[model samples]
Target: MKAYFTYSCILLVFVLQACQSNRKTETKNGGIVKYKITGKVDFNDGMQVYLQNYDNELQQFQKTTVKDGEFILEGELVSDGIYNLIVKTDYKDKDTGKKSFRITYPVFLENNCDYEFKVQKYRDGNVIQAAEIITNSEASNNLFVFEKEVAKVKQTWDTRREALSNEAAQLKASLMTIGKGEDSKYNYAIDRMREAGKESQELAKKNPREEVSSLFVNKPEHRTSLITPYLFKYITINENNYARYWTVLDSLDASIQQHPLTIAAKAKVERVKNFYEQMPVFPSITPRNIKGDSLDISKFRDSKLLIIALWSSRDRFSKMDIPTLLNKEPQLKNLGVSVIYLSVEKKFEEWETGNKSLGLGLNSYLLNVTDKDFIVNNYNVSSFPTYIWVEPKSLKIKELRGGDPATPDFLSAIKKAL
Candidate 1:
């Protein structure tokens, strides 16, 4: 089952204000919810704890204490959403001797739920394992799976590499003996031996049993770059983001020369290299309006600020965030900033109906562009809801894919352009 979760704005304002304060508040929601934190570290009595939302924007709620190996951070839950809770400590490591802090997994704060998250760090002589417990099910699962896979892959790769290096070196030395003599027969033998060695390497790669185990086995590391990059490339190709695929494929080619027979490693480099090569170039390409009227982007040359928002009618995020920007059109216009919407829908009729149903502003249009394939390959868009800021007079791109359009950072960027 699919579900859409919503976090209302009313509670966000109150929580945001408290976090911005230099001091920590011990009470919230008429003192109904309270929290405390404790840790061992050499620092002042107070530390800064940050609560971040998904947009990478900081909210106004924070915890500000870590004294006597314990602390108390109290606040009311504003809404249910994902958050990356971080604790900043001044404790320095004995080995590196560098001061550092740690991050906690997602802490879902449900409304009316008095949530308490415990943070712990244990040191076994010189080793430290930091852990946290929260009620966020999704974050816990994501962190757990990611940590396990990454650790296992690193361990397996390190061990297998040592073994492979020894084998490759031995084979190379054995094959080079044929080249010792100066005669033509010796040169032929050397070439034949080299071919034999490559055949052996290919045999090692074709062993499906070993390769399959590497992907699923709990112990031995099996996946190599030669194979993995292609997997990523396939996904990008399916998404019609050929530009990204070409770039990845090219990078893979260079790595293959260095790593030689490491299939997984080689594959990764090629995927990125291929991704870059597939990207389309736009040489002063003009954008078309909804009425099929071609409007050269250069026509906005007189304006100091030109903001372009690229989105599709079917995209749920665009549906939410685009309207938010348009709602503040009057203020944006007052700052001498101009905005334009470009559609990535396949059909012109789809774009028209979508634009009209959404009640988009005057500046919004269904551009001739269709789908992310055309947009991403041509413009190199890496993420959805991408905003491009252009200095029209100079035709130089000020910034591509600006800040989150739904947040205040986007507004700040627009004001700076004017």
Candidate 2:
């Protein structure tokens, strides 16, 4: 009886021990993973750390307190996937009293491992100092390891943009110096700046994959209407990004060009194309017009003189002059000249308003168009309110880009075209 009782006690103890071991294994794989951030930086205790998981959407996973130059970040690892951790040193500027920042290296968070982002701040006594970190990760995978990669690229872009802007401003200052006939160094500075701009552009082209504009646009959050225009602006500055800009524009245009009633994508395409026309050409088209009408540029073949006017509602000069030109419609008719208004307006309301205001002549037609392939490549309209005079008999382009007063050499080109 005593031996049987002892055997039962031993069996119960082994069962309990096995269950405890299973629980620890489960916790290690599927439960909360803890990370400790220790650094020797002289910042306030109020500093905080934020962690963002880079899935399809950047979901914030954890946050922790920065007390005594240390932080304990705890979060659940529901699955065996990689995550991105962002650590920001939150503080207020000493001089400005406004909110300031110092962020640490982004570390990749994987299951069952604690990663640290060791950062060293630049000695400069600025509100935000440059930082450097050495990590054992490749640049591509750094997306998971460091949130600062994006921020660092953004900072470098701003610095370069500011330098270019300052150089441009200095060029204007050079005119003043030259006017004074001062034997100044302004010309030399201007020459050096021009060379620097060329060098910068060459460098920008070499590493096309590293462009911030491309990275920013591809972000899932920015793949929408409101943000696309802003992205276009950034892409336009780097002419090497023409293909990147066109791909995005073409994709958006394709999605919405079918629904003429919905002006969101249509209008965006127009504005983007209009802006891009100033640069290299990448023309695309919507088969349908704003009035639910189909466009066939081939119909203009019979006219004796076809004046193609590339105008936009957003263009101040186009808005002002289109009305006057429409009022002179009778004069154009008597002279056997046909004027076609090519509107770049995106919204139906803006398009309607522009047409009604212009009151274009009997020989005129309003065709809503967008895409780089349509205007710059097909028609070669380089400037806004651009005028192209074609031989009515042959439909051959006789004059290209007759200027507006606001355009470079506007008066001279208009007189030549007329």
Candidate 3:
């Protein structure tokens, strides 16, 4: 069986905001799998329907139109898993000539599966209503039963998803518009943000995989919407982290450090307020690739900036942080910074699996177990997913993530270097 992987996972963990990791649909021997879904809706003709999967991303599977209260959706299941079954239509009333209405349901799917869904006709003031979806797939049927059982229970984050996501988007918008509100660029940015916010809210209801959003969504939140404050803290604090409290703390922007939500995150770390003013010289060492081939750091000295990310597959932060950084690869490349992932996993088998599972292990390599002690000691590698920014020529090393936010991060350092 071949299982393609998505960066989002269906686990009880979240990324910076809500993204996580998950594996994509699978097929045996890479053979194509098709799915057919026929359904009846109480909704009138011209109704619109869509199928999508939420994995920190709203992945559109298929889109079709409804005719005369019935619809048919048949497509190649790029991979088999649960997807969001969305129903939308336009209604007209005396008060308003036309209004739009939409609702979503979670549906389970697999290869060669035939499913049926019925949206019983009912209306409240031009608004169609359906309490639960009627489906044919047993897995989907069981899921509907589970959703009904928990229908009345509202999670704390369930209410907070919209608010926090809004706040985060607003904060980002404020950052870009701080002194450029009158600029056309700022205006365009705000418009896009509004669209993203609206999409995020809708995905939150439709995606059962996690907290889905249109804008910058996090993983755990994407795979599963169970991102309570407690879980947030647990994902960040419960891991085997070894970096200094001040290291990450100082790396954040002054504004972010003081943000109301981040203030709580700030309280957990220990920091050395004033560390060395200069970047420390990196200790020379040999690195190895995934196939246990040797590497010479000298060959990379000509590169403007190099990032050696030390992480482990078993670490939670690695699972989340790796994907996030990889997503920013284009920006990093524009700055002439090259990234190398060095896994310190105990077993090579697990390292290989983790690399595939995370799906962002493009330039990943394995740290020599025999060389672990010396590297760990000199590099200040006390945590999982530590990024070491090296100026190979000068051999100066700056640990990234949380620093002075002035020149500690890769972007800032690249700017200063250039």
Give lDDT for model 3: 0.57
Which has the higher lDDT value, candidate number 1 or candidate number 3?
Answer: 3
| lDDT (Cα, tens digit) per residue for candidate 1, span 1-418 | 1222234455677676665331122212221223333344333345556566643655546666656645555555443344566666555545754445555455533223333445345453222255655432332333344445656655665556556656656655765565545567555555665665555554444433234323432212212122323223223232243344344444443323232223343365455444344433323555556555665666677777777788788888888888887877677777766777877778878888878876774456655544445657656786557887766676555555666667866776676455
How many residue pairs clash in model 2? 12
Best prediction by TM-score: 3
Each candidate structure's TM-score, on Cα atoms with residue i matched to residue i, is 0.33, 0.33, 0.34
Q: Residue 389 in candidate 2 has what lDDT? A: 68
Can you give the lDDT of residue 99 in candidate 3?
Answer: 54
Q: What is the lDDT of residue 205 in candidate 3?
A: 56
Residue 216, candidate 3: how far off, in angstroms? 27
Question: What are the per-residue Cα lDDT tens digits for candidate 3 across 1-418?
Answer: 1232333442323552232122121112222457777877654577777887744335787788878878898788654345687777766554654457887877766443457766555665435576455543334554564455344233543665666576657757676545744666666666767766766665465533222111111322222211111112332331133143334434543323333224443454322222233334665666656665666767777778777777888899888778777776688778777777778888889988998887854377777766666568755678887777776687665444322222336455456545
After best superposition, candidate 3 residue 59: deviation in angstroms?
A: 4.1
Better of 2 and 3 by TM-score: 3
Model 1 poorest ten-residue lDDT run: 22-31
Model 2 — TM-score against the truth?
0.33
User: In model 1, which runs have C-alpha deviations exceeding 4 angstroms?
Assistant: 1-283, 369-374
Model 2 Cα lDDT, one tens digit per residue, 269-372:
45544544544222222334445555455565565566667777778888787766666546666666666666666666776776666664343344444453
Q: Candidate 1 — what's its lDDT?
A: 0.52
> Which 10 successive residues of model 2 have the least lDDT summed?
253-262
Best by lDDT: 3
